[model samples]
Target chain A: MARCRALVRPALVEAVGRLHPWTGEMAAYALGWADPAGTPDPTGSEGKGVRQALALLGAEAVGADGAEAVPGAVAVELVHTFSLLHDDIMDADALRRQRPAVWKEYGTGPAVLAGDALLAQAVAVLAEAPGRHTGAAVRRLCGTLNDLVSGQAEDLRFEDRPWHGPGAVSPDQYRSMAEHKTGALLGCALALGAVLGGAPDRTVTALDRAGRHLGLAFQAVDDVLGIWGDPAVTGKPVHADLRRGKKTYPVLVALAGGGEVAHELVTLLSSGRPVDGEAAELVAALVEEAGGRAATRDEARRHLDAARRVLRETPLEPTAARRLDALFAHLLDRTW
Target chain B: MARCRALVRPALVEAVGRLHPWTGEMAAYALGWADPAGTPDPTGSEGKGVRQALALLGAEAVGADGAEAVPGAVAVELVHTFSLLHDDIMDADALRRQRPAVWKEYGTGPAVLAGDALLAQAVAVLAEAPGRHTGAAVRRLCGTLNDLVSGQAEDLRFEDRPWHGPGAVSPDQYRSMAEHKTGALLGCALALGAVLGGAPDRTVTALDRAGRHLGLAFQAVDDVLGIWGDPAVTGKPVHADLRRGKKTYPVLVALAGGGEVAHELVTLLSSGRPVDGEAAELVAALVEEAGGRAATRDEARRHLDAARRVLRETPLEPTAARRLDALFAHLLDRTW
Candidate 1:
């Protein structure tokens, strides 16, 4: 993980530098290279390098130097950054990493351009990479972007949906959205890394599946944190997703029971307003009491186990595969 | 032109069909595939088939069937559509093609996603093409997208600059923006089409230059139309560009002169309100008196001549080259 981070930051910087100066500044802020005031932050505030680590480990699993996967790693990270920038604009999210979001700091139009530039950069870096596999990798990444956009469309559409009845959000629907929104990019990262590493087709497919399962597990963990994790650790308002009326796994699972507690939980969440203060705590408690929290944990465990099973079955380089397993464990640390 | 349009429409519809359904609907509306209420529009409202015609003719210029260049043609056309959808959002323009812009009809977030999906599909179609040159084509298209974003960034920033100062938008800067925003994709269309048709690098580069020159000429013509063309012919309100305070060739050149007309022109334009009715007519007259109209026409002719010179110099197929010249004449028909 540390090694991939070291390889990633410099290469990522070079890739992003290819953008226009104005858009580059906004992108720098989005990727944690600068503060909201546009001053450089030497101590960068980037997310844990899960996508990059998975990419490098994917290359290593095919017995290639992880350095060979640098372009794919940079590409996936940029796509992730692109999604964050645009998602904030769509969601009207005011803060990112406790700083002003890109749209907030730079205005909506500039934020849109910044995101577009990053996505362009992502495709450019990979397409220009020297490899017979680069074309396939580019197609894979582009296809993932299609799925990611669809997932986001659904996520936004969910807000307009009722909290219960035939039109209500379901666990199955939430899982599919998670798979598309978060899992598709993560899956592409590992698969693209393997392709760049010159892995066999079967190995690439296996790694992609493994990464997707890991992505779903990671998303469930994130949903849990959004509601119950410590704000000091999560870097967000406590019960932030609940306050936003986000259709997360725990709350939906809790509501699916159709009992009195489920009915009461629905009433609170269906009010079409930001659930806050004492009401937020009660909402959380009701979700837990209705078994939403436990159901979510079980879903996480199920996906994580599936990922582990796939890894065990695949004939990857032992050391690299083990490292990947350790990395996933570190990401969703509660399971371990 | 008719043949290329025939080839382009169905191919474009097929390509756009690959997008997520919701986004696909908005893109369909943007591309003249459907009406605002999402009904199919058999009488399509698409733009002139300039880019598509250029791409197909490029292949034929390289001694291949025009049909061979379908993917590249489709890709460039989608990129153009993507830009229009996003540009309308940034400009806050309510109308496009006598109807609501994508953002107005579908809302901003979905509009953003719809544009993104088209871009992804653009790169995907090119990368997935069956040829040895597919990689180079993908890289070329992606690089063009980066430039397109930069061009858009500059255009938006120009709005914040003073009308006359060191920080003012220069003719040179406007030319650069026009190249990036408008020319890049057009250049890629011709260049990628030639590449896919198996042309040598030099030939590909020549077509790219021709397309860019043609783009500059086309933009100048469009700028003139924005201010002075018949609204019935242009399908837009009279003085639309002046009303919106857009930086265009004639207006910028008119403002460049240090004279009475320039001073009054600056005063009227710098007030930062939409110029309309009698005031708009006066601005038009002042621009004409300051030699802006003639200067713009001269600039367009200069670039068009350069494009012709390049085409004459290149060793392309005679039949295709003649056909391409005719297409150019038909497009910039006024001067011809």
Candidate 2:
């Protein structure tokens, strides 16, 4: 993985730099390469680069040179970056990766431009990519982007109309949001890999399904951690979702019966009252009692298992498939 | 123009439909095809579709079948629509073409999606267009889109900082913005015409230069109208630019004098106070006194002259060239 990252860095940098030369500096900040002012600086922040990695991983999964997927990888990363920019603004997030979010650091206009730049670059990269499936690649990238935005629209609506309300959000609705918001892109990541590898339709479908399941499970686990996990590990305050009045999977399951505690929690959240330490502790206690925590874990496990099944069904080589299997296991057991 | 509009309607419907099958109904609302809820009703909405008309007109300018430019026309119109979506959001505009803006009706999330969908379709149209300059066309379109966005960024930034404020924007700066925001796409319209006409580089350059001038003039005229034009005709209140605190060409030119009225207008706009009735009249008076109104008109006229010169230089056939000249004359001379 380290070698792969190293190999793709120059290509990624070159492609992004050339395509978005004007906003490349701002984009560099997004990719953790520079500061907000478009100046050169060391210690640029970086992500786990999971999407890019997945692109290459997907390529390898179907017996292609991982390097060949570099453009596709970059395209996926740009899409993800654009979403993070808008998402930060929509959520009014102050921090990202222990630093001020894009909107916080540079204000809304630049933040929005930064996202637009990334989106445009993503298309440019796909358009100029050196490979077969040029038309298909662009179309797929666009279709995935369209779905991601649609998912965001649904998510925004869900914010004002929480599924759980005084109760909890259903697993189904949560899954639906996760699929649209997160899973669609992940599925695209896998599909791009298959497309690059010149894999058959059946194989692409299997990989895409695997990605979808994995994405849902990943989101479900994130919801669990958002409410009950340690802040230090998750980089967020404990019961943050609850405090923010979010209807995550665990909370929904816990409030399915709409018990007294659930009702109290809902009232506290809806009233916009301060979520103090005592309230946080009580919410945690209620979550535990409502079986929300256990239910989330169980659902996450089921999806992960389902993802692995799809992975096994795909026509991946033994070595590549083994690596992916290990990767999934690590992700499934992620504490953060 | 009426015939062009009619021919383009089905294509617009079909293009947007393919671009967003499910959400296409919502897109129709954006294009003035349907009401906010997808109800079938055309209440004298849908702009003159000036870009599409220009595209078809340009096709005729080069003696190509007007219908041949439908996809190209649609492509430009899509870009135009995307700009409207983003601009409405940025400006917090509540209405468009006498109806609720997409962002106002559907909210920011869907507004953003609608823009994305349009951009994607624009590229798709170019990709599928069976033209010799398809590759160059796509690149030019992308380049034009980038320029517009960067220009918009500059425009947004100049909000708090006037043309001659802390981040004082110069005429050169304004020119760059105008070139991108309006000129580049207009250039694309003419370039698409030449591509269809199989015109030489010299002819293309003349058309492109003419377009650039036309765009700059149009923007300048727009700025002039924003402050001093009749409200009923422009569909904007008197001194709309002054009230909104926009650093338009005239405003910028006047600010260069460092006059008290310019200072006062800047202060009033930045204070977030409403500007209407007496305040609006006062701003209009101040702008005229500062010579902004006259300077803007003079600048616009200069561009119009330059554009006419280029049109004369171009090797367009007599009849087609005459139509082109008339079309541009009307565009430059329009009151609203």
DockQ top scorer: 1
- Candidate 2 accuracy as TM-score: 0.84
Clash pairs, model 2 backbone:
A164-A168, A168-A252
Q: Indicate the residue-level lDDT of B179 in model 2.
A: 86
DockQ (Cα-based) per candidate? 0.81, 0.30
Encode model 2's per-residue lDDT on A154-193: one tens digit a residue. Answer: 5665676644444335667667878878888888887787
Output the number of the TM-score-best candidate.
Answer: 1
Fnat of each candidate? 0.76, 0.19
How accurate locally is residue A208 in candidate 1, as Cα lDDT from 0 to 100? Answer: 93
TM-score on alpha carbons, each prediction: 0.96, 0.84
Q: Looking at model 1, give its docking quality level.
A: high
Best-fitting candidate, scored by lDDT: 1
Q: Interface RMSD for every prediction, one decimal? A: 0.8, 3.1
Chain A: TM-score in each model:
0.96, 0.92
